[model samples]
Target: MPPPSPPPPSLSPDLHRVLSLLPRLASPRHLLQAHAYLLPRGGHRHARVASALLLASLRLPLRDHAAALVRRVHPSVSLRAAARLRGRGGGGLAAQLHSLLVRAGHAADPHASASLVQAYCSCGSVASARRVFDETAASADVVSWNVMIDGYVKSGDLARAREMFDVMPGRNVVSWTMVIGAYAQMKQPEEAIEVFRRMQVEGIEPDGVALLSVLSACGDLGVVDLGEWVHRFVLRRGLCQEIPLMNAIIDMYVKCGSVKKALEVFEGMEQKSIVTWTTMIAGFALHGLGSEAVELFRRMEKENVSPNDITFLAVLSVCSHVGLTDLGRWYFKTMVSQYKIKPRVEHYGCMIDLLGRAGCLMEARGLVQDMPFKANAAIWGALLAAARTHGDTELGEQALLHLIELEPHNSGNYILLSNIYAEQERWDAVRELRISMRDRGLRNVPGASSIDVDGMVHEFTSRDGSHPSLHKIREVLCAINSNIKSVGHIALLPESLHDVEEG
Candidate 1:
C-alpha cells in the first residue's frame, strides 16, 4: 500500500478562532479540549496562546492543573498573565503565579515586580514582599512605590509605611489613602485625621477612598462633627452619587453613634450594596431595635439584595439579644438549607449562646453534639455557663473537663471550674481543684475594668490608683456605699446566710 498522507500541520481558521476564544469560555470541559488540541502542537511557545491557556486553567476548580499550565508558560508572559487575575477574588493563585515568575526571572519589569510585592502582601508575606522591594532594580515607578507603601500599611508596619510616605518623590491620592488607612486600621484616629490634614496642606485632592478612610476614623473616634463635615465635603465635591462613598458615609454615621444621620445617609443614597444593608442592619441591632433590624433584613431581601455571612451574623445577633428564639431558629435553618451556607464556628457559637441564654440547655448541648465540626472554646464556655446557671452539675463538670483538656495552659479554665464547684457549695471539690491548680502553677487572673470618658479609654486593674482622678473616684465610691448602707442594705457572710435561710 502507498504511504499514508501526512495530516495538515496548521490548524484550520475555524479551529484557530475557537482556540483563541478558549480563555473567554466559562466551561472547563470545552477549555480542556482546546488545551488538549493546542498543547501538544507547540502552541505553548506562542505567548498569547499560552497566556490564554494559563488563564483558563487558573479559572478551573482544580489547582494542580493550574500550576502545571503556569509552569509551561514563559516567565514574563506568565507575570503579565497573572496581573490580569487581580481583584477577581481568586485565593493563593496570584501568589503562586508571582512565585513562579520570580523563580523564572521576570522580576526585572517594574510593574511585574510591584505586582509581586502586592501578591506577597495580599498573601500575608510582608517580609518576602520587603525582600522583593529591596532587591528589585532602582527603576521602580509610582505603582511600585504605592504597592510597597500599601503593603507596609496593610501589614500593620505603620512606621515603615510612614518612612516610605516621607521619601516618596511623588505623592498621589493612593499614597495618602494608604497612610490614612494604616492609621485608621491601627485605631489611631487622631493620627489619621492629622494625615488627612497633611494631605490637604500638600494640595492633594481627597478622593472617595481617602474620604472613606477619614470618615471611618472619625466614626471610630466618635467625632460626630467631623463625620458631618466629611458628609458635607462629599456633597460639595459632587461625590454623593458614588455608591461606595455613600455607603461609607452611612457606616460612619452609624459607627459615630448617630443612627439618625446614618438613616439619612441611607435614604439619600442613589445605590446600595450588600455591605450597606448589612451595616444598617448591624447598626439597628446594636441600638437595641431588633425588630427594626429584622424588618430591614426583610426589606433587603425584597430589594433582591443577597444576604452574605455578615448579614446573617447581624440578624442572628439581633435574635440573640432580643430573645427571639423561634425567629432565630428559623433564620438559622433558612441560612443553611435555603442559602446553602455551611454554618461557620461563629454562627454556631451565636446559636449556642442563644439557646443557652433561653434556658434550653439540653437543646444547646444537642446542637453542640450535632455540630459538623468540633466545638470551639466559646461554644464550650457558653455550654458551661448554661450548665452552671441551670444547676446541672454533671454537665458543668463535663464541659469543664473538656475545656481543661482543650486548653491546659489557660488559668481561666481552672478558675471557672473552681467557681462552679464553689457555687454548688462543694467545698472539698473546690479545695482539691485549687490544690491541683497550685501544683500546675496556675493562678487567677486579676480582675480589670475600663471606662471611657470624653473619647479617652482608661483601664484599671483591681486596687489600681494610677489614674489622676483616683481620689475623686474613691470619694464617689465611698459616697455611693454610704448611701447604700443608709438604705439598710447589709453585707452578710455566706455561712451566716446559709444558717439563716435555705433555697
Candidate 2:
C-alpha cells in the first residue's frame, strides 16, 4: 500500500484557520490579500502559513512576494518551495532563487538542486548550470544529467553535449533524442543515423520526436530506402496520427525525387495542417510540377486552410519554373491585395525572373526599380542573366557593373562579363578583362556534377581522374569519340575561358 499521506502540517489554531481560508484563495490577488491579513497578524513567523503563501505565490512572476513567502519556511521547506520557481523560468528570477538556496545552505538538496539545474539551463547559463551539476555529480539523478546534456545542445556546443552524453552512467529516451537531434541540427546527418542505430542497440525504443529527426537526416541524404523503413516502423507501431511525423514523411519522399510517393502519403493523411499543405505544395514546386502545385494551393484555399507567407513563396517559385507569366503575375497581385501578404524580396525576384524569361526584359527591369526596398544581388543577377541570354550587351553591362560592386569577389560575375564581350567580338575588351581578372587573383571555381544511380551518387569534375572506374570510363569515352569521328562530326576547343594566347 502507498505510505499514508503526511498528516496535515502542524500549525497553531489561528494559523490553521488562516490556512483553511487560503484554500478559498486561488490566484496572485487572493494570495496577496491572504498574506496581508496574516503577516500583519503575526502569522508571518509560522512555517505552515509560509508554506501556504509559497504555494499560492508560485503563480506570480514577480519574486518579491514569492521570495518573502519562502523566507519564513524551514530550510528544507524552502529548498522544495523555491524549486516551484521553475515555472517562472528563463529569467534572472530562478538565478536569484538559486542564490537564495545557496544562501540558505540547502545547495546540496539533490532534488531541489536538480530543479535548479533546469532553471540555469533555461536561462542560457550553462556554465552555472554545469557547476551545480558537478556538485551533484556524485549522486546525480538522471534528470540532472539530461538537463546538462540538453543545455549543451541548446548552446550549440554539440561536442560537449556528446561528451556529457557518453559519460552518463545510464541513458533514457530523452538523453538519446538530445544527442541525435544535436547531430541533425549540425547537419551531420550521417553521425545522427549512427547514434540512432546505437540508441536501438542499447534497447531504447524510439519515440516520434526521435523518428522525426532521423527522417529529417534521411531526407537530407536522399536516402529513400532508409526513410521507407522508418515509415514502416511508424505505421507498425501506430504513430501515424501525428501530423508533424506525417509531414516529415512527405518531405522525405519529395527530397528523394519521388513526388508521386509524396502525393500518396498526402492523400492518405486523415488530418492536414497548414504545414501539411505547404510542404506538399513545396514538394511539387521543387519537382517543377507547376500546374499541380497551383492546383493544390487552390484546393487548400477551398478547404479553408489559410496560406502563410511561405505558401506564397512556393507558389511563386512554381510560376517561375513553368513559364506561367500570366499566372505568376496574377499570384503576385493576389498575394498583396487579396491575401494582405507583404511581398518579400524572394517574391519580387521570382516575378522579375518570370518577366525576363518571357521576353519582357524592360518590364522586369521596371519591377526591380519599383520594388519598395532596394533590390538585392539576386534581383540584379536575374536581370543580368536575362540580358546575357538575349544578347543585350548594353543592359548586361549595366547590371554587371552593379553586381561587381555588390559581390566584388564573385568570379562568376567577371567570367560572365568576359563571355558577353567575347560573344560580340569585342576582343580588346575581353583581353583587358582577363588581365584584370589575373591582377585581382580571381579564377572560376571548378564545377562538378553528380548523378545518383542504383542507390549510389557519382560525382565528376572536368579533367578529374580520381574515380575508381576512371580507366573504364575513359575507354567508353574513347569508343564514343571514334564513333563520332567516323560519322564526320567535328569538335572545337577554345584556348581559354577568356583571352587565348596564340601558340
Candidate 3:
C-alpha cells in the first residue's frame, strides 16, 4: 500500500483540526460540507487548508471538486501535490492542476513551474512538459532543464536530450551523469566516454552515478585501464561500500576480459547482493570457467541466497558452454520446479542451445514444439547451427524455414543453409539456394571486431583495409598467426567456412 501522505506541512491547531476531519469524512457530500465551512471562514486562503481540502476531495473520488479546489490553493501546494500524484499515475489530475496554475496567475513561480514540469515529465506527457518548459525558459533554473532532459531520455529520445545538454547554459554533476548514463544505455559507449572526458576537463568531479555509467562504457569498450582507474577512484572516495557501484566494478572487469580481476574483486567483497553473486557467475561463464561457476553458485545457495532468474540464466549458459548436459537439465528443471520462476524466452533459448550443442537435435526440436511460446529467430538459428555441425541437413532445412519467416531480411540464415548444403556436396542444391539469395538481393554482412589500444577503440571489419594503421596491423596479425601455427594450432573447419578470408 502507498505510504500515508506526509502531514500537510505543519498547520495551526485550528487548521490541523480541519485536516483531521478531512480524512475521517466518509463521502464527497461530507467533504463538500467541510469545504463549504472552510471557504467562508477564510481558511481556503491558507495553503495547508487548501491542500487538505484538495486531497480530501481526491480521496473521495471527487475529481471535479478537486480540480475546482486546486484553483483556490496556493500554487506551490498544488504543484507539490501534483508531483506526488504523478507517482500514483495521476496524469489527468496533474494536467488539471497545471491548467489551474496558469489560470490562477502562478506560472511565474519558479519552484512551482519546475515541479509542474517534473510532474508532466513523470506522467509521460513530455510534449506537455516541453510546452510548460518553453513558457518559463526565462525563469527556468538548472533543475527545470534537467527535468526536461530526463523526460526526453525516458521517452527514448536521446538525440533530443543530447541536443538540450549541448546548449544548456550550465551543468551540474546530475546533468553530466544523465547524458553519460543515457549514452551507455543506448550502447554508444564511445560517446559516453567522450562526454565523461569533457566532464572531467571542465573540473566536474563525478558522483557515484557518473562513475557507474563511465565504468559501463569502459567495460563495453574493453578499456580495462579506465575501468581499473574507476575502481581506484571508487576505493579512494569510499564508494566501494555501495553494492551497486561494486557490482558495476565486477561487471566491468568481466567484460574487459579480465576474469581473474573480476574474481579477485568478488572474493574481497565482505557483503554481496544477488547481483554481486550473479555477476561473478556470469563472469565465469564469459571466461568458460564452467566448473568455477557451478562451485560459486553452490556456495551462494549454501549461504541462503536465492538465485534469481538472471542467476539461473548465468549458470545455464555456463553449462551450455562446457557441455554439461545432465547438469544443465537438472538446473533447468530445478529453476521451474523449486524456484517457482516461470521460464522466459532467454531461458528456453539457453536450454535449446545447450541441447543442440550436445548433439540432441531431435530433443531440442521437441523442446521447441513443447514450448509455451512460438520459437523465435535465436532459437531457430541455434538449431540450424547445430544441425550444420552434426550434418543433419533435414533439421537444418526445418530451422531455415522458420528462420526465413521470422526474419525474412536476415541474410545470415540463408548463408547458413547454403553452407550446410555445400558441406554435403549437394552442389545442385547450393546453386539453387544461391540463385534464391541473388533474386532476393541478399548478401552476407561483414563480421566485425574491435580492440581498445591506449584508451582508444579501434574497430575492424572483415576484408576492410581502411584503417590508417593497416600495414602495422597486418604485420602484427601475421606474426601472431605464424607463432600460433608453430605451436600446432589448428583452425576449426566448419567455423572457418563463414570467414571472409576463406571466401
Candidate 4:
C-alpha cells in the first residue's frame, strides 16, 4: 500500500470531532489517516473515542486494524470493548483479548482489572470473573464490587450476590439500588425495604434508579408512608421530570390502595407516556372508578396517543368492575377492528368476566368457545365466579370441569364449584364433590386477609389465632357481630355444617 495520507486539514483533532468522524470512515485509508492524527494527540486514551474506533475497525472486518487499535488504547477501554464484543465471538474471543492485556502488564491496573472481570462476567464465565476479582480484591474499587454483584444477579445467584454485597468494603447508591432490586425480583420485598432503610441511614442520596427500586419495594409491601417519602425526595431533588420515575410513583400509590393519591400524582404529571395512561386506568379499575377511567381513556384518544394491548385490558377491567357490559363489548371489538391489535388472553378474560357478571352466561360461553387461543385457568375461573354469583348451577359445572382439568392441584376451583352446588341445595352433588376432593388429597386452602396499621402490615389466615392482640380483636368482632344481628341482619354461610362434616 502507498503511504497513508495525512488527516484532512478541515478535520479537528478534538475528541468529539474524532468520534464523529469514526462512523463516517468508509475506507481503510480514511481510518488510517484518522488514526494517524488521533494517535499523535493521545486521543486513544479516551474511552469513548477508543471504543468508537474499536467498533468501527471491527465493522470494517479489519482484524489487524482492530488488534492494533486495541493495543494502542488504554487497558480499560480495551477490556470494555472486549466485553461489548463478546456477543460477536463469546468467551473464546474474550479470553484472547484478555491475554493481550495480560501480556501488556495491564491486568494489574485497577480500572482495567475491573473491566476484565466484567468482560468475563458478561460472557457468562462467572467462575473466571470471580477468580479475577479474588486476585485483585485488595486494589478493587466500588466499580469492581458493583460489577461482581451485578454479575451474580444476572447469573441468578442472589444468595451469593447479597453475601458479596454485605462484605463489600463500602457501598454507594448503585450498590444499595442493585441489592434493593435484587430482593424485589426475588419476591423478598420486605428485605428490599429494609435495605432501603439502611441506605437512608448511611446518608447516600438515592438517584432515580435507587428511588425506583425502593418505590417498587414499598409498593410490594404496601408501605405507603415510605413511598410518599420517596415521592417527596423526587420532588426535592427535581427528578420528577423523569417520566419513568413518575410512573413508578403512580404504581406504588396504586398498589398501596391509595387510588386518590395516585390520581393526584397522575393529574400533576406534565408529560405522560402510554404507561402513565395505562397505569391510571388500571388504578381506577382496581378502585371501581369506572366513569373516571372511561373519561381518561377518551381523553387519551383525543390527544392522539395510541392505545396498546395493555390499555384495552385496563379499559375492559373498568367495564367489568362497574357492569358496563355493552361498553366492554364495544371496546373489545374496537381493540381489534380499529387498532388492528390482537386480543390477548387477558383481554378475553376481562370480556368474559364482564358478560358473565352481567348475567349474559350464554354469550360469555360463546366467546370462550370462539376465542383463538386455548382457555387458561383464569378464563375458566372468571366464568365459574360469575356462575356462582348468578346461581347458574349448570354453567358452574361446565366451568368447573375445565378448571379441574387446567388446574387439578388448585383447591380454590374445587371449593367454588362446591359452593355453587350448596347454594342450590344439591347436597348429594356437594357430597360427591367433597368425596372427589378427598380422593385427590386436595384440602381447601385457608383464606387470608391483611390490614396495614401505622406503616406495618398485619396478615391473618382463616383459623389462625396467633396474633398477640387476637383476644381483644375477637372481643371487638363479637360485639360488632351481635349488634348487627340484633338489627335483623343474617350471615350467609358459604360453607355449611353438612359440607364441612363430609370431609
Candidate 5:
C-alpha cells in the first residue's frame, strides 16, 4: 500500500504561540476574543489552538460556552482536552468527552484508555471508569490498575479497593499506599497497620506516604506506642528529607495527646510547611495552653506562613476556652477582612460559644439573630445556655423555641427548657415541659462519665452498679459527700419538694 500522506499541519507558529497564551490568560473575555479570531478559518487546521480554546472554555465560569467549544473541536483534539479535564470536578463534561474518545476509535490506545479512566474517576463516575477498564483491548498496565483502585478508594469502597489490590497481577508502592490510605481514612487503624505489616512482610519497603498513613492510623486509635515505633522506623530509614512525613509525625503525636512529643517533632524538623505550624498550634490549643497557641500563631505569621481556616479554628478555639474574648473577636475580624476567608458556620458557632461562655448573653443572642445564614442547633444551644446562666427566662424560652424548630426530636432541647424553668422556680412550667417531653416520646440522655485507665476506656452511666468495684465506688462517694457536709456545704432543697411531699 502507498504510504499515507502526511497529515496537514494544523497550527502555525504565531497561532500556536497565541493559543499557548490562552491557558495563561486571566479573564474569560480574553478567551472569547481568542475564540473569535480562530472560529472563522475552516481550512486552517489549528489543532493546537482548537485544544487550547476547548480548555479555556472549560476553565471559564460559564459552562455553556465551554461545552460549545468542546463540541466544535475535532475528536483527536477533544481527547487531549479530556485528559486535561481530570481532577477538576467536571462530571458531565468528562463523560461526554469519554464518549467522544470511544467514537473517535482512540479507546484502544492504552494511554488514551487510561486517560479516559482517570477522567471518569476524577468526575466521580466510578461505574464508567470500570467500564472503560473492562472494555479496553490493550493489556491493563500498572497505571490503569492504579487508576481503578484509586477510583474505588476515592469513592469510599474500601472492600472493592482491597479486592482490586489482591487480584492485581502486579503491585507497586503506589498500590500499597492507596489501600493503606483508604483504611486510615475510613478510621480502621488496625486494618491500616496490618496492611503496612503485610507490605513489609512481602519485602516491599515502606515509603514516606505509606509510613504517614500508618502513623495517622496509630494516632486515631491512640496507639501511642505504635506511633513511637513508626517514628523510629522513619528515622532508621533516613526518610527525613520528606517534610510531609515530619508534619505527619507531629500531627500523630499531637492527636495522640502528647503535646511535648509533638513539640519535639516540630523542633526537630529542618523545614516546615503551613501544616506543621497549624499542627503545633492545635496541640497547644487542645492542652488548654492558650497563650502558647497564640504565641505560636504569632511566630507562624512572622515566618510568613499564612494561616488557613484550620489554623484560625485552632486559635479561636483556644481563645474561647481561655475566655480571651477580645482576642477571639479580633482574630475573627482579621480572618475575614485581611485574610479574605469568609467565616463558615463553624466559625460563627465558635464566636457564639465564646460570647455565651463569657456571660455576654445579649451579644450572643444578637449575633445569632444577625448571622448571614440561619442559626443551627449549636448556635441556639449556646444562646440557651447563656440565657440560663444569666437568669433570662424569656430569652431562654425563645431560644428553646428556635432550637425545637431546628431539631424537634432532640431531647436535650426540652431538657434545657425544663432546667431553665426549674431554675426560675416555675414548677408548673417545668411540669408542663416534662409532660410535653413524655408526649413527644423524648427521653433525656443518661449522664455518663468515662475514664482512661492504662490505655483502656471505662465508662460509668448514672446510677450504674455493674462494675466490680461498685461497693468501693459507693463508699468513696459517701466519704466525699460527708467531707463536703462537714465543711458546711449545705445542699439547698427546693420549696416545691415540701409541697410535693405533703401531697
Candidate 6:
C-alpha cells in the first residue's frame, strides 16, 4: 500500500499533536478540545482532519457534529470514495461519509442511504436511523433493514425490532439471529425460543451465533431437554467446540440444575478457558460439592491456569456453602499470597460469612474492623446473622447498628432486630421496636412462598391477601397448622404486633 498522507498543511504543530492521537484519543473530553481547536481554523475541510476526528469520536457522541463538519467542508465530496469508507468499520465514519455523499446530491443512492442507517444506529440514534430507513423504504436494501433491526434490538426497543422483523419481505440468517438475540438479551427467553422455532419452521438453519443464543434462552428457562437436544445437534453438525460455545453448554447444564452433567462436559473438554473452569467450580459450589470445587481449583493450578478474581470468588463461596471455615481462610490467604488476587468487598463478605457461621463472631467483627475497605451492608448483615445464630446478643446488636444505618429503609433489618429481642423473651423491647417501625410507616417485607399444583405454579406472600384464592388459601393453611400442632410440632413463630402511632 502507498504510504499514508502527511498531516494537513494548514494544521499547526500543536494541533498536529492532537491529530496524532486519532484512533487513540484519551477521552470524549480530549476529543472535544481537539474539535474546538480545529473547527475554528477551518481545518475540518481537510480529509485527514475529518477522518481523524471521525475515528477518534466513533464511540463518542460527536458523530453528528463530525458529519456536519465533513458536509460543510466538502458538500460535493466523491460518492464512490465515501461508499468505500462505509465498507470499513465504524458507524461514525459511515455517518460522515453519508453526509458527504448526501451533500453531493446522492442522498437516494442505495449505498449512501444504507450507510446513513447503519451510522445512525451505531451512534445510538435509533429513531433517526429509522427515519432514514423509512424515507428510503421503497429502495431499502436487506442490509439497511437488517441494520435497522439490529439497532432496535441493541437499543432495548424489542417491540419495534419485532415489528421490523415481521415486515421484512425476505429474511436472511442475520435478520433471524438479530431478532432472536434481541429477545434473549431482553430476558424474554420464552419469546426468544418461540422465535427460534419460527425460524426453524421457515427452514432457516441457525449458525453458531444463533445456536448459542438459543442455548442461552434454554438455560435461562431451565429447559435441560431443549439444551441437550441442541448439544446433540451441535455435535452432529460438527460445530467446533470453541471456548465460547463450550462455556455456554456448560453454563446451560449448570443452570438447568444438572451440575453433574456440567462436570462431565468440563472433564471431557480438551481445551478450557478461565471462564470454563470458573463455570465448573461455580456449578460444584451451587450443587454443594464444595470439596470438588476446591479440588478443581487445585487442578487448575497444576494445569497452570491462572485464577482471576472470579475464580477466587467461586472458591471462597464453595467454602462458605459447606462451612469449611479453615479451608475458606486458607483459600483467602492463597488468593492474596500465591495468586496475587487482591480481596474485593465480596471476598471480605464471604470471609465474614464463613467466620460468622463458624461461631467466630469476634473474629468476624475484628476482620470487619481491620479490613482496608469499609465494610458494606452485606458484610455487616453477615455479622448480624452470625451473631443471631451464636446468641451473641452484644455483637448482634453492634452489627445491627451498622446495618440499620446502612439500609435504613430495609424492613428486614428492623424485623431481624425485633426477632433477636423476641428470642430472649424481651417482649417489651420487641414491642418498642415494632412501635418505632410503625411510626416510620415501616412494615416487614412479606416472605414469599410458592407451590406447584398440576404443573402450574401458584405463589403467595406471608400475611398478604392479594391472591384471588387467599381466603381459601388461609383456610387450607389453618388446617395444615392444626394438623402440625396435632403431630406434636410447636412452631416458635413471632407475633405481628405493630402500633401505628406515627409521630
Q: Which one wins on lDDT? A: 3
- Judging by TM-score against the true structure, name the best candidate: 3
The CA lDDT of each predicted structure is 0.76, 0.78, 0.85, 0.83, 0.78, 0.76
Better of 2 and 5 by TM-score: 2
What residue pairs clash in candidate 2, if any at all?
none
Question: What tens-digit string does per-residue lDDT give for candidate 6 at 271-379?
Answer: 8999999989988888889889989999999999999999888988889889999989998998999878889999999999989999887788889888999989999
**What's the CA error at residue 260 for candidate 1, in Å?**
3.7
**Pairs of colliding residues, candidate 1:** none
Error of model 2, residue 298, in angstroms: 2.9
lDDT of 2 by residue, 332-363 (tens): 99999998999999999989888877878989
Each prediction's RMSD over C-alphas, in Å, is 9.5, 7.8, 5.5, 6.6, 7.8, 8.2
| TM-score (C-alpha) between model 5 and the true structure | 0.69
Window of ten residues with lowest summed lDDT in model 6: 494-503
Residue-by-residue lDDT tens digits, candidate 4, 348-459: 9999999989999999999999999999999999999999999988888888899889999898988888998998899999999999999999999887666667867787
**lDDT tens per residue, model 1, 1-503:** 11322333455575578666876787778877887777577565565666667667666644466666555554555655655554425436565666556554566667678777776677667676777787773787778889888878877789998988898878888889889988987889778988898998899988877888898887777676767888998899888788888887888878777898898888777788898899899999888799889999999998888898888998988898888999999999999898888889889888998898788988998999988889988888888877776777787788888888887767776677777788889999999988988898888776764543654656666544566876676666566667767789863333322322331
Error of 4 at 353 (Å): 2.2
| Candidate 5 lDDT, 1-503, residue by residue in tens | 11322364566665777767887888888877776676564322455666667666666654567555444545556656766665546767676666545554556778778877887887788888898898863498998999999999998888988988998877999999989989998988778978887898999887778888998987777667778888898889887768888888888888788889999989888888888898899889888999999999999998888999989989889998899999999999999999998888888889998998898877887887787998888888888887777778887888889988998898987887788888889999999999988998888876665544554545666545577766665566566657767889863333223322332
lDDT of 5 at 16: 71
Q: Supply candidate 1's per-residue lDDT for 16.
A: 75
Which parts of model 5 are misplaced by more than 4 Å? 1-79, 85-105, 136-138, 186-191, 298-309, 329-345, 370-377, 388-393, 400-503
Candidate 3: misplaced stretches above 4 Å? 1-67, 84-96, 431-442, 491-503
